[model samples]
Every structure is written in C-alpha cells, then in structure tokens.
Target: MSEQATTPQDLADDAVVLDVREQDEWDAGHAPGAVHIPLAEVPARIDELPDAEPLPVICRSGGRSGRAVQWLSAQGYDVVNVEGGMKAWEQGGKSVVSTGDKAPEVL
Candidate 1:
C-alpha cells in the first residue's frame, strides 16, 4: 500500500501487513509482526483481519496475494498486493522472522 518494499516496521500507523502464506511456509519465515491468515482461511477468518487501512498483502510470490487483494477489494477493504511477495522482501534486504527455532528463510 505505501510502497512495495514494505516491512512490518515500514507500515504506517494505520496500515498493516498480512502474510497469506500457508502454515509451513509461514513457519519457514515471514516478516516479523505480520498478521498471518492463509489465503484459504481468509473468508472464514474475515473477523480476524485488523480494522486497519492500506492492508499490505503478501504470499510466497505475487499470485496468491494478488488474488487475496482482489477479493478483499471487492469486500470493501483497502488492500494491495506486495509485488513479488516475500521473495522480493528478502531480496530487498528486509528483515524476516521464523515461527520456530530455525532461522528465517523464504519457502
């Protein structure tokens, strides 16, 4: 939403980062502080989404997140797909964190 290079810390006060990757992918690595809601769970987990604007959505790559953005947009949420997703972030030198004891890595 703000910029394609968005990290958790880079988001504005009213903005939030959503990682729509699966459990395994998320456990592999993700942006620290990002709200995770796997793409498949988005509909049932609608209430879990933060009431924030400019929701920055991401996945392993741009495909899933792009679909999420399209669906969320139709539902009246302000969302944008993070182009290239986590791969772009990792390549861009943005920080990543793991859900387990292992080091962070894009999966």
Candidate 2:
C-alpha cells in the first residue's frame, strides 16, 4: 500500500515515528517516543521498523528525512517523509524529550 506523507499531528495512533538522527542528537532532544536509527544505518536496520503499517520518518531538518523517504519508498516500504522534520514538530507544539547532556554529533 502507498503511504502518503504526514504531519506529526496526522500520525496515526499506532504509527511509528522514526527519527533518523544520530544517537547524540536523539539524546539531547527529540519527539517523545521516537525511535532512533541513524541515517547511514537505516538500510541495514530496516528490519527494526514495524511492518504492520507505514512509518513517518523525521530528522533535525527536513532534508535527511526526505532522503530517507526516497530510499525507503524505492525499497518498497510504506514510509512517509515528515516535512520540516523536528523543526516542524517543535513548531507544532509537540513535546520533546531531553537528556540534559551534550548535543549529539551530526553525521
């Protein structure tokens, strides 16, 4: 099934929000309950994602997530690029979880 792109608010109750940012960035702050799988590792880690439905991909900015969407879509996975990424989520007033530590290294 084709999965259309969605906003944080449009995410289904059971949908998984995949954060493609590196570990440190994730630890510093991220969408609550987001799953971290660095961009470079996504191809190998694809199995870690849920297969029941499409997943929403997110990044610090929209760029990485959009790239991920392209790759995943080409791979036949049901995925959506979250436009504007975390920036959009923050602007939408969504809650972010912070680890109170140093920021993560951007890969």
Candidate 3:
C-alpha cells in the first residue's frame, strides 16, 4: 500500500496525530492533542485509532514513526509519517503538549 507523508501544518488542519514514543518520552513532552500509543503497543492498540481518515505518526526523530507508518499502511489503514517528527514540529514553530498529571499546552 502507498503511504502518504504529512507536515505539521497538514496535521494541524485535519489529522489524528499519533505519538509512537514510549511512555517516558510522552510524559516528558508531546504534540498538543496527539494520541499516545507507543510503537510497541500499536499492534494491539490498532483498534484505538479511527477508521475514517489517515493518521499521522510521530516519534522523537522520525525513526519509529516511519516504522509505524509502514506497519499501519500494510494493515490497510491510511497512515502518514510526519517527517522529522517532534523535533521538526518544534523547529517549525508548532505547539506541543506536556504530559504531566494533565496534558498542558506548551508554546
């Protein structure tokens, strides 16, 4: 299956942002409104994702998310790999949500 790539801007418009990082990484910081499902758990947690549109997968440096895109796309789910991941999101002047007791918006 062919997989698409998405930019942070595209993600902001209309897409479900999936953070494939581990719990610790997610707790440290993550994109605001992003869904946290570590790569290790995605196979079992696939049902948690919506079935309507493509979802963008993100990781710290794009590695894990790329793998996720590959895996999910193979499973027939519309998935996009967010190039450059969270680092790019921050570099692109996008917003992130810190995962503390409650996720807080970070400028």
Candidate 4:
C-alpha cells in the first residue's frame, strides 16, 4: 500500500469513512456513519465529501476506493484509500450496520 492507503487498523476513531461501494453492497453492511456514495456517483457527489479533513474512502476491497482516491486527490481533496476496505473492517472486528433490520455483514 502507498502512503495514500491505510488498513482498517489505522483508521481514526472519529473520522468519517466514505463508502464508495454499490447500493447492494451498502445495503448488506457498512460502518456506522459511513457515507454511501457509489464509485459511479462520485463525480456528482464531490460536494458531499469532507472538505477540511482527510477522508477515508472504502469499497468491497481496495480496488474501487483506490480509483476514487486518485480522482479525488487530483481534485485537491485530501483523501486516503482504505487499504483493505470493508472486508478488512469486518474482519478486524469493527462495527458494521445494515439497511432495514438485516444483520450487518460485508457482502
């Protein structure tokens, strides 16, 4: 991983994570308070990203988030790709939440 990538273990306690996974993936499971904006929607959702803080971007694995970080960085956003994304998050024993009443699991 580059300096722009961070493992779930390195995530900050209070930082808000920006989830760039698709809607179905998001509906299955995600970190509580994570912002849901699919990779395809980022161009239109740039206004929603954190402006003053370093945003942590995640996806199913690291692939999509890595792409997002590259684009977001080019636009001057201080962003970091979550190295292992949500899969690592769940495996690291971090909390996960789901839409509706479903149990949260990384799909």
lDDT of each: 0.80, 0.76, 0.78, 0.87
Candidate 1 lDDT tens digits, 6-102: 4433554334578899999999998875899999999999899966577789898788988898899899988877777888878877778888799
Q: Whose TM-score is higher: candidate 2's or candidate 4's?
A: 4
lDDT string, candidate 2, 37-59, tens digits? 99999999988975545778889
Flag the better candidate by TM-score, 1 or 3: 1
> What are the candidates' C-alpha RMSDs?
3.5, 3.9, 3.5, 1.3
For model 2 the TM-score comes to 0.80
In model 4, what are the clashing residue pairs, if there are any? none
Lowest lDDT 10-residue stretch of candidate 1: 1-10
Residue 79 in candidate 4, Cα distance off native in Å:
0.4
Worst 10 residues of 4 by lDDT: 6-15
Model 3 Cα lDDT, one tens digit per residue, 1-107: 13478777666733458889988788777877688899999999988875546778889878899999989989998888888888888777787667667653322
Q: Give me the displacement of residue 19 in model 4, in angstroms.
A: 0.3
TM-score, per-candidate, Cα-based: 0.85, 0.80, 0.83, 0.93
Task: Candidate 1: list runs displaced more than 4 Å.
Answer: 1-15
Better of 1 and 4 by lDDT: 4
Question: What is candidate 2's CA lDDT for residue 35?
Answer: 84
**Which ranges of candidate 3 are over 4 A from the true structure?**
1-3, 13-15, 101-107
Kindly give the number of clashing pairs for every candidate.
0, 2, 0, 0
Structural RMSD, model 3: 3.5
